[model samples]
Target: MASKLILLEGVPCTGKTSGARFVASQLRGWHKNVRLFTQESPTNPVDLMNYAFLTPEQYREFPEEDRVLFPVEETENPKGYMIPLTELHESLQKELESYRFYGCQPWEVERPLMLARWRAFAKEAMESDAVWVLDGMFFQNPVCEMMMWFDLPQAEIESFMSELADIIRPLEPLIIYLESDQIERRLREVADQHDYEWLDSLIAFHTGQSAKPNEVPDLEGCVLCLEARQLVEKKLMSKLGLDRVILKNAFTDWVEAYNFIRARVYEKTMGKPSTDK
Candidate 1:
């Protein structure tokens, strides 16, 4: 079979991580060569992982001249040079954070750089001979963040995603959408975690709430923005025409969601139900 990439995605607080992990576990249980790639997972497609981790301050601090590097290991692979990952991450952390630098404006630089990195990752993964179960896809990163960066219409965003789908089509993508009917309650559910500062920051940033008035966004505005973002995501992703398995409010209904996805994936892989789907 062709290499596969299963992407888990959903609104904030919708248990994307838990679901992705469980699905990957189930796939593995079935004796498949499935690899799970979450944001925190150390072993991931290097470019994608690095892009996800890039910070706003790091991006702003990155200098212009540090774009690409020339690695002279053999002294004559004239076409061979490295994009300095360490140097880039030192200033700008990941592709998502680049949105803070001015959204699509930074696309000119970020687009080529990240595209090259993703190609490297795709090539490497294809050769590694493992199916990828990614906790987040490009749609979640630069794409969702881009929605916030620009005043793009849903159609345009969909167009962008379609283009990306084509670029990574070699992996035979499968998107798993974990959705929720309880956005407000889910936010509170996530708030209950209350331990990690990163979680706090993520909540604040996603909700559009600034600590001080005029220092950040207003609460209501942020909530609406997030809703709009999720809505567009759901709509456009379906338009991508990739195989998809969607579960409603998977955050609260994990086991049901897990079983549903497990069965679907089995059927997809083997061309038959695992045990009466």
Candidate 2:
């Protein structure tokens, strides 16, 4: 039997990567294998290349019915709109067409086929003793289980999610929302610390003005904004029937939040140390 796979999903800068790493480190201490996968990592150039093949024009020209190849649009209340991609017929058809071209389409190029691929990957990862921690805008991919982070402003989260809804919605991964005060804070931090000149240049090249800290292209699979972590916790528990979800602080206090999640993950994956100790 394969070990359980726990996925930590959230918007950019929601501490998904950092939190996953911390959790993985703790898991390793217990002799468990863990693999951290991020959409932004350069190691997975194949994934990037595949994404790059779909030019902006191709993306825009993709029939609305084919939009299942894309990510899910972010909604003000993501939990309320957790519909699976299989339900979007037009979008699924387009995705099958793309799959056929890639030669990765199985015997049945349908929604169930696509979903099966995800399950297979998760299962394979687990068999290898790897707990896959995926950090990306995966709001569209429907999985049997998921943990979505709902920590951002409503307008901002929606804006980011709209951009990727066209390419990643088919995977149907479960969501893990993180609650935060202002989504922009995370974006600004990344831009400030990392080289976001490309984004600025792109905006200036088009709009003839340096893109403001908050003005950038939307990421895929983001959804929802909550006033507090409690609201998010209540919604996930009620909607998914999961009693507890790992809730971390906003980007500003990411380090502390990371530690908290790490500790919880350790306890869950490995029982507390023996009292004899």
User: What overall lDDT, based on C-alpha atoms, would model 2 receive against the true structure?
Assistant: 0.41
Candidate 2 wrong stretches, greater than 4 Å: 1-3, 42-113, 137-177, 197-237, 242-248, 273-277
Q: Say which candidate scores most in TM-score.
A: 1
Candidate 2, backbone clash total: 32
lDDT of each: 0.60, 0.41
Error of 1 at 172 (Å): 2.0
> lDDT per residue, candidate 1, 58-156, as tens digits?
434545554333111121122222232333444433533433322323444445445555676677767776677887665666565557655556666
> TM-scores, in order shown?
0.74, 0.49
Q: What is the C-alpha RMSD of each candidate to the true structure, in Å?
A: 6.2, 12.4
Over 168-200, each residue of candidate 2 has an lDDT whose tens digit, in order, gives 223222234454545555545666787677446
Q: By summed lDDT, which 10 consecutive residues of candidate 2 come out lowest?
A: 140-149
